[model samples]
Target: MELKINRPTKGVELCLDLEKRSQWETLEARRTELAKDPTIDQRLSGGPVTEVAREITQLEKEMAAATVTFTLTALSHREWSRFKTEHPPRKGDKGDEALGFNEETIFDAVIPVSIVSVAGPDGEPVEWAPEKWAPLADEMTTGQYGDFKRAAFGLNLGEAAARLPKSLGASLVMARSDES
Candidate 1:
């Protein structure tokens, strides 16, 4: 019997809930503090810990309901290779070699190709395009953009590959490990 190797077509799903996420974080912090409070007995009915926990659970449901989800798939070997070749690092104005690939450039190039689908909070389909990415990215905070870029890269490359330092050499390493 011959063993067959399938291409990486499976998509990774990532969700973002900006509004409810902050509230969830605040509630989680309150729960942690309540867990340590001597006055608030965790085993007692209607205690602070239990109340905070309940709030957290409710907030989680709300967050899930409000979240925007993205589905991303890995690029084929040829496609990824061509992208890297097209976006090679360049020299600075002073003729110094660039330290690494630009994060924005990487995100801009990779995200559109990697995306399979996008859905809004209500599960309505959201239109996605390469042109839309820059404007959307501009509206996001640095942390938010980083999170999205990380997810996109992680789907196209392995998580380990995505997290690798953004050096020219690192790009080569990622391409070599495309099938992993």
Candidate 2:
């Protein structure tokens, strides 16, 4: 008999299209305002309302076409353990003492290690370095940064957690099904 084990070597890709996202948000707001106006006759405002909808659909297509994908790889168990040890929980009189990990500190430490590559909107490869993580994060909007952080964490930790069954019964069911 032969046995082989495969570790997780795959990277997760996350995409953010800021320009198109902002444009879509603006168009959505305009559409919402137009929707709320009780006095505006649909017949009279139809052209403007339709225009906004059309813009939204076009923007969706453009956003898909111009996606810049970021690839994040998981840290090995040993590397993850070392990172946790290096950034041990702080004990102090401050409220942060109760929280095992400081969110910002964790993000700072994890994001750089997890990011593997980035592709530009035009599908060209973009140069990236772990050292540039801070400056890149600073240039992003709050929402964009949050999203990037989430993707990094998800690739590192959340993927394993997400694979767990909801309960023991679910696990049993899955095992039994697999046996068949």
Candidate 3:
């Protein structure tokens, strides 16, 4: 069930019943609905044509101003302090907090790695298949792994056991399994 990598160490995979993120889908649907509605139509106005035209033109300007503008409120003091710890408050501390995620720079490094048969540096074709480690994916949205995020990745694993919820952490499987 693993999707082999293009080329690195053969990456592991798990068979997940992936589904669309509701947040992104809802945004798309709303955008489509808004585009279908015309807030001000110049052609629909009729009253001493020139006066109606002027009014319609003004309405068009206001309608244009109504375009979506995302306003991100400043993080609260507690949140700001946490963000500072994660992504520093000033330029000098950036390296210490954010590391490679510099303020002005994006995308740092990447090298293609084939998980299947590929020619090595010596020109010999090496056979490799990406290892597939199928840990059970949370099937229901209401499950413990409902969000399925990096933060929730290893709640069932050892180490950082104190960070997990009591009810959930107590259920982690600690048995050794060589099959995976």
Candidate 2 residues lying further than 4 Å off, grouped into runs, are: 1-23, 36-46, 58-67, 93-100, 159-180
* lDDT string, candidate 3, 104-172, tens digits: 211100101112334433345445433321122223233323222222222212245324335544344
Summed over model 1, clashes come to: 0
Show the colliding residue pairs in model 2: none
Which residue runs does candidate 1 get wrong by more than 4 Å?
1-6, 9-17, 92-102, 120-127, 155-180
Put down candidate 2 lDDT per residue, 5-107, tens digits, no spaces.
3333333333456667888999999989987788666676456778899899999878767666677766776877677666667676353355345554777
- Tens-place lDDT per residue, model 1, 1-180, is 999643343333334557777888998998888888888767797877888889999988776776676766677767776776666655552221342344436667887677677888777888877677677667777776676676755655675544534688978898889958
Using lDDT as the measure, name the better of candidate 1 and candidate 2.
Answer: 2
- Compared to the true structure, candidate 3 yields what TM-score? 0.19
All candidates: TM-score: 0.66, 0.64, 0.19
Q: Rate the local accuracy (lDDT) of all candidates.
A: 0.68, 0.71, 0.32
**Candidate 3, overall lDDT?**
0.32
